[model samples]
Target chain A: MTDVAVIGFAQAPNVRRTDGTTNGVEMLVPVFQQVLGQTGLAKEQVGFWCSGSSDYLAGRAFSFVSAVDAIGAFPPVMESHVEMDGAWALYEAWVKILTGEASTALAYGFGKSSAGLLRRVLALQLDPYVVAPLWPDSVSIAALQARLGIEAGRWTEEQMAQVAVRSRSAAAGNPAAQLSGTVDVAELLSRPYIADPLRAHDCAPITDGAAAVVLAAGDVAREHCARPAWITGFEHRIDSGSLGARDLLAAPSAAAAGRAAGAGTVDTAELHSPFTHQEILLRGELGLGEQVTVNPSGGPLSGNPMFAAGLARIGSAAAEIMAGRAGRALGHATSGPALQQNLVCVMEAR
Target chain B: MTAPLSAPLEISFDYTRSLGPVLAKFMTALADRRILGSRGSDGRVHVPPAEFDPVSFAPPAELIEVGPEGTVLTWSWTDHPVDGQPLDRPFAWALIRLDGADTGMLHAVDGGSAGQMRTGMRVRPRWAAQTSGQITDIECFEPATQPARQSAAEPAAAAAGQAVAAGQAVAGQVADGAADGAEPVTMIITPVRLGYQHTASTEESRYLRALQDGKIIGQRCPACQKVYVPPRGACPTDGVPTTTDVELPDHGIVTTFCVVNVPFQGQRVATPYVAASILLDGADIAFQHLILGCAPDEVRMGMRVRAVWRPPEDWGTTSENIDHFEPTGEPDAPYESYAHHL
Candidate 1:
């Protein structure tokens, strides 16, 4: 396999809403410029382009295609899109580089979660015939998972509250985060439950944002940056979709992906845990010990921009290595209800 | 910058599905107020029966009546309800393991309060006031008011192809899910509705603003120098926003077109009209518009045409301000001039 390293990463400001259109061109234009500028690579020199986004978020079909306008794709560049999160798109770009198709590639994702009732819209991802018709909102589903773990003695309500407290406090340093401030665990615990077992603080804010990452193979990666987060392993896995079939407290998919990706003890970890308890479950599943620093970038609970948040996790992890913050880092992304799908990328400074 | 023009947009569709034999049997049984599940190869009965056995990877051979009464495995209370849920009032959503079934199915439980809901509480399917053989036939599960007792025919009844279960709430239950032997619920229709606030990009908004003034405006790409009417947010070739707005005449030549002989939903024009891409005078790109005032057969590529505007009073920030396009009676432009657009 080619030695592909993340050469640059950039993201738009995470916020509850943006005045931009759903196609994401406005959110993407600035980030594209920022990522290219960070790598000191010209747009014409990049070889391949891929993106992740969803039509459901846009409420229009082929919305991602219109996002290409941000790239000014005239003379048509080689491009592809996935309805999945941008982390999966990054996987596509990584494969493109490994296959020797492109020396340098760019991957991006964006979502205007503010365009629709986010939690309500997400219900569409469930089983249409059996599950979706009931119209179980996303928060309610997560609440179900949280209650299961709590009842199973896997985690506690206080521990879940602590996760939120830590995330918001940590997010104080991240300008791209949507929710950040000093918060007390007890104060969060006292808050009324939005969905029985879950509180407002326990849920990631609905954010509209975009993120981009640039990758290069071997020598180009080395020449462009003094430090590159070299990709050691990238793996993704998925479990059964039925909500009743699998154990909710255990994210078998994340555990399997983490094991396959060699997500060993790392100095830093950027996990995509939209719910507070999910962070605890993921930490146990991925085998990240207490010594490992988690969500210094505040993670998704601080600011989750749907399809873009997962990709930003990878980029944020790479940024840590690029900035000489850690020797090795792990970035994890999840999709579907109760973490049914997961992708793990382990990176090291070189 | 001023906020881009925005409007509420609602997209809806009715997704039609055809259930296979296994689900067909399961759904058809539900209409008859019975609960059926597929007995997996491992001897575990699955509720909302799996079409194929997860372990064996084969179609389930046995269909069993699990329970109308069951225990709540896990539940979360919904204090505030959203649209389309089984219950509009406050309720608990639970996973219920029905009698004689090893696996559980998710359904709403009308427990009324958080204190009343628990992991081990007993519940029973509250048959809908009316059932149509859909999963919603069980409107929701309700806490069982009667004592929980084991049914008699539970074990051998399923293997015997009996639709009745033992020690369950079902009494005098009809076994005929498909008495006429008609194809079991082969089709189901689900209506999907979503709402969004659609925002026009800044450049598109600018073009729309121009349309309100009864003028045609195009923008020039700083790098490629191509003119785009209804200017795009960024130039396709240059990766830059078009900044220099240029005004052009409404008259142009049709680069290409198609005669719409077939009709579709929400089409305003009658059949046999031409929808053409018009290359506005001095603009490098063409935009779609209707061609009228002539027979559809006469609408040809490279033909000269001009916009026919609606009365000025009716004009707004919309391209609909132009009713259609009509021929200028001038000879067609040379095909070479607009060939690149095609």
Candidate 2:
């Protein structure tokens, strides 16, 4: 199999809202230019293009198609899209390289989450027949999981608050982050609950952003990047969709993806955990010990741009290795309620 | 450097779903104020019954009557409820384990306050005054201490108890209306509505603003040099924004057209009108617009046409400023002039 590596990555600033359209053309254009410029690759040189976004987020059908305009996709280009997070699109790009169908690929994900009442719109992701009819907002569903862990003695509110404090402090270094700076855990605890057991600091802010990553196989990667983050393992797994049937405290899917992707020995890790408790929960499930540096970019709790945040996790983790700060790193992404679906990518400097 | 144009956008639709045998039976039972669970191959029952056994991936073997009362396994309080939730006031969303079921079901509990909610609190269904074949038939769960609402199915409670003891499938029995030759629910309709602030791209915004002044503006792509009317976020071929603005005359030739005899909802024009692709002079792309002031058959390819604007006083930032196009009373251009546009 051909070895694929991440050669370049770029992202838009995470903001509460963007004046641009939901199609993401405005947000995506600059990131595409930046990523391509970093790799010194021209638009026509990219062999395959894939993206992740949701029409439901845009409140318009076929929204992703209009995003191609940002690519200056003139003439025609090989392209595909997934109604999932951009991390999944990266997974597809990796497969395209491995199959020898393309020597280089560009994967992107974007969302204008502020276009709608994000939590209410997210209810549509639930079981359409039964649960969605009741319209349980996303925050309430996540709080249900947080409380389960709390009552089970698996994690506490203070511990969850500590995760928030650490994430915001880490994000102070990330210029693209929407929320950053020092915060007191005690102060966070004193805040009123948006959903009982969940303070505002516990949840990820609704953000509008876009991200792009360039991947190349073998010689093409070496030609562009002096120190490429070579992908050692890539895998994803999903659990039961029936929320009531599964054990919410245990994310079997994350564990499975972690084990398959050889995540145990990474020196650095980036996790897409939208809520504070989830970061703690994922830390246990992925079996990352205290030595593993986590969320150097502050993770999703700082600024989660829906579909784009997951891809940005992979980008951030790969940067640690590409920058020679880490010998190996792991990037994890999640979808569905209570971490029902998960993807893990382990990269190494070679 | 001004922001793009934006407006409120609401999308709504009713999705009618057909429930298979298992859910059909389940929903039918809800109409009678009874809760049902599906018995999995593992012998564990799933509330709001699973369409298929989780372990075996086979259709459920049977549906069993669970409980009108249960214990909250976990919960979170919603201080201010959003639209479409089961309750309007402050309520706790809980995972409840009904009596005789191994798994939990998600629903709301009207516990009155966060202080009243706990991990193991007992609760019972607060049935809707008018039962429908839907999950909302049980308005929400409340403290079991509250008196259960009396229903017409009171006489069958003893029989239901006997069936539970024997672990028998009671969907056919408890859904009494079905036993008396009434139809089981075969379908359900769920209405979904979402609102968003729809925004137009900067380039498109410029074109729309120009239209309000009765001007047709096009932009020349820096890379391809193709002139695009109404502009574009990026020139599709060059992957770059069209920078140089070009003003075009309203008069253009119809590259192609279709006579719209069929009528659609919300259509402003009557049937048999011409909808043509107008390729304005000095522009590379064609835009769709109505061609009128002539018979349907008289509307031909390469026909010369000019914009028919609505009164200047009525103009806004909208394409509707152009009421329609009419014949320019000039000779039609040769087919060669628009062959490439088609």
Candidate RMSDs in order: 6.1, 5.4
In model 2 chain A, which range of ten residues has the least summed lDDT? Answer: A69-78
Candidate 2, CAPRI quality class derived from DockQ: medium
Whole-model lDDT per candidate:
0.87, 0.88
lDDT of residue B62 for candidate 2: 86
Report the C-alpha displacement of residue A254, candidate 1, in angstroms. Answer: 0.6
lDDT of 2 by residue, B234-304 (tens): 78776677789999999899999999999898999889899999999999999999998999899988889
lDDT, candidate 2, at A74 = 59
lDDT of 2 at A197: 90
> What is candidate 1's fraction of native contacts?
0.71
Q: List, residue by residue over A181-282, the lDDT tens digit for candidate 1.
A: 988888888899888899899899999999999999999999998899999999999988888878888999999999998887688999999999999999
Candidate 2 clashing pairs, residues 3+ apart or interchain: A72-B239, A73-B236, A74-B236, A74-B237
Residue ranges of candidate 2 with Cα displaced over 4 Å: B148-181
| lDDT tens digits, residue span B1-342, model 1 | 777898999887767776667767777777677889889899988888888898998999889888989998888888887766767678888888999988768888888799888899999977665455677777778889744333223222221111222111111223334625433565566667778999998888888889999988899988899999988887877777787899989999999999999999899998989999999999999999999999999989999999999999999989999999999999999989888889
